[model samples]
Target: MLKLDHITVVPPTLAEGVRHVQDCLDIEVPFGTRHEYMGTHNHRLQLGDGIYLEIVAFDPDGISPRHARWFGLDDQKTVRSNWDAGRRLRGWVASTNDLRSVLAKHGEIFGTEVPLPPENPVFAFAIPKDGSLPLDGAAPSLIDRRGVPVSSEKIPDRGAVFRSMTLEHPEPEAIERLYEELEIDHPPRVVTGTEVRYRAEIETPSGLKELT
Candidate 1:
């Protein structure tokens, strides 16, 4: 029911996030849109095949929402803790057509769906009540685009093509089982590790590069 949409890089700040991507892929990501409702912003780059990469961070100038911010940005302590641990290539978002159905079946794992930009909402994103990552980044975050695809042209392309992503988790078997149940297409490869983290292989202008 779900497919890979984009990979995310979480950092302490927007500039740091962009720099992390640049250091990894050796290309500067272009500025993307800001989520006024969610009170965050991002820098994005196209990665071919309808997939992209984003460096998302909290927008200090943005008005804080009543609810928890997405991607666990509201939890600055944990965000910095993960960043300091070198888990920069943190998570990925998956697109689903039947978000309500998925949430009905796995609401605890994916969280409740909320329409963004409340007044004139365009899409529904599943966010945990505490705004934590799905399985703490062991699994993909869910996004229902309302049947509209994110335009690759709008996101700059620096000759980057997503090769694959791998996830390291303490309980790889559990995560693997969850992916099987989700029926996800192009899901990240999951393996055993001390903690949850992700590594993506991308074909960039400088040749194949790994973004952690």
Candidate 2:
């Protein structure tokens, strides 16, 4: 079954991304390893359940494949806010033990799986190459780096946790059917929206805060 894996945050640069997140949430994000193949590095934040947050950015010094070069970094601008004023949360990933079979089954509905480095073996279902997720007011395609998914052991979790996640779509029936076909857990609620919004309840030092 496909499960809600984690959310990815793309920033112009690795350092700026980490700093921006720290300033926004008033929390420290731990550093993670770099993806030599994609020219990307990341910082991680643990959430409730097995979910986590990944702040990823392109590293010019690293070797990135030609196909993965059309993300946000190409524009040379940094993300000032975590949610891009609510425009973020462009897409998400679903975990599976057999990604190849899943991709083959859903290939017609969801575009082909983006290839990842051998070291990072996870696959993703994303929009077609011509259709991309919008970022910085532009629609850019989404890519998945499978093998490098955030491991459960790495997230610190602190005191906060993710209770649940909901994906809103105008075609709720179609989305529901897709989830059912993929054997993913249907969210308790579905709302209407052109883009996806991720809401979570997290435990903070002051108290509990609902993160949207």
Candidate 3:
């Protein structure tokens, strides 16, 4: 079954992105090696419950763009914005084993799957070359690195664990249908907003804290 995987943070540079997450979450995050094929490198922070947050950025010195690089900042205005001023939450990714079939069923909901390098062993979803997906110009792209996701292992949860994740969106029925199409395990509860908001209940030393 498909599941809500992780979220992405797009900063203009890897160092800056890592710093941003560290400041907001008040934790230490480590820089990971580069995905040569994607022309990007990242840092990871664990958010408990097999979920993580990734801070990613293009490698300025790399020669080619990675196949699944999300966040369309190729243009001057987008670049100037620096992936939505770095304050935006960007987007989320869903993962499934049967990606090919899933895409065939809901091809209209997203863009083409960018082929990752064989060495990288993952696939991803991003806006189509024609710019579909109604991203509001600030969403980060969705990526699924094959095997186990990096965040599942690298980031330490300290003492916290995710109890549940709740998503808010308009057109509850339609969104519910989309999740059903993907075979996602969690059934999203419908709300009034066009944007997706995540509410996670985490266990800490003090007590359970609701993180939004």
The prediction achieving the highest TM-score against the true structure is: 1
Instruction: Give candidate 3 misplaced runs (Cα > 4 Å).
Output: 66-68, 73-76, 79-87, 119-127, 130-151, 154-160, 163-173, 187-190, 194-212
The most accurate candidate by lDDT is 1
lDDT of 1 at 138: 84
Could you give candidate 2's per-residue lDDT for residues 80-190 as a string of tens digits? 343456534334445665656765765544445555554555544344443334322121123444556656787766665656555556565765665567676533244
TM-score per candidate, chains pooled: 0.98, 0.70, 0.70
**Looking at candidate 3, what is the lDDT of residue 149?**
64
Task: For residue 19, give model 2's deviation from the true position in Å.
Answer: 4.5
lDDT of 1 by residue, 76-163 (tens): 9999999989999889999999999999999998899899879998999999999999888887899999999988779998899999
Residue 111 shift from truth in candidate 3, angstroms: 2.6
lDDT of each: 0.92, 0.55, 0.55
Q: lDDT at 72 for candidate 2?
A: 45
List, residue by residue over 13-91, the lDDT tens digit for candidate 3. 7776666555555455677668776566777656665767666666777646634345543342543364454333444
Error (Å) of candidate 3 at residue 105 is 1.3
lDDT, candidate 3, equals 0.55
Winner by TM-score between candidate 2 and candidate 1? 1
What is the Cα-based lDDT of residue 171 in candidate 1?
92
Which regions of candidate 1 fall more than 4 Å away from where they truly are? none
**Candidates arranged by TM-score, highest first:** 1, 3, 2
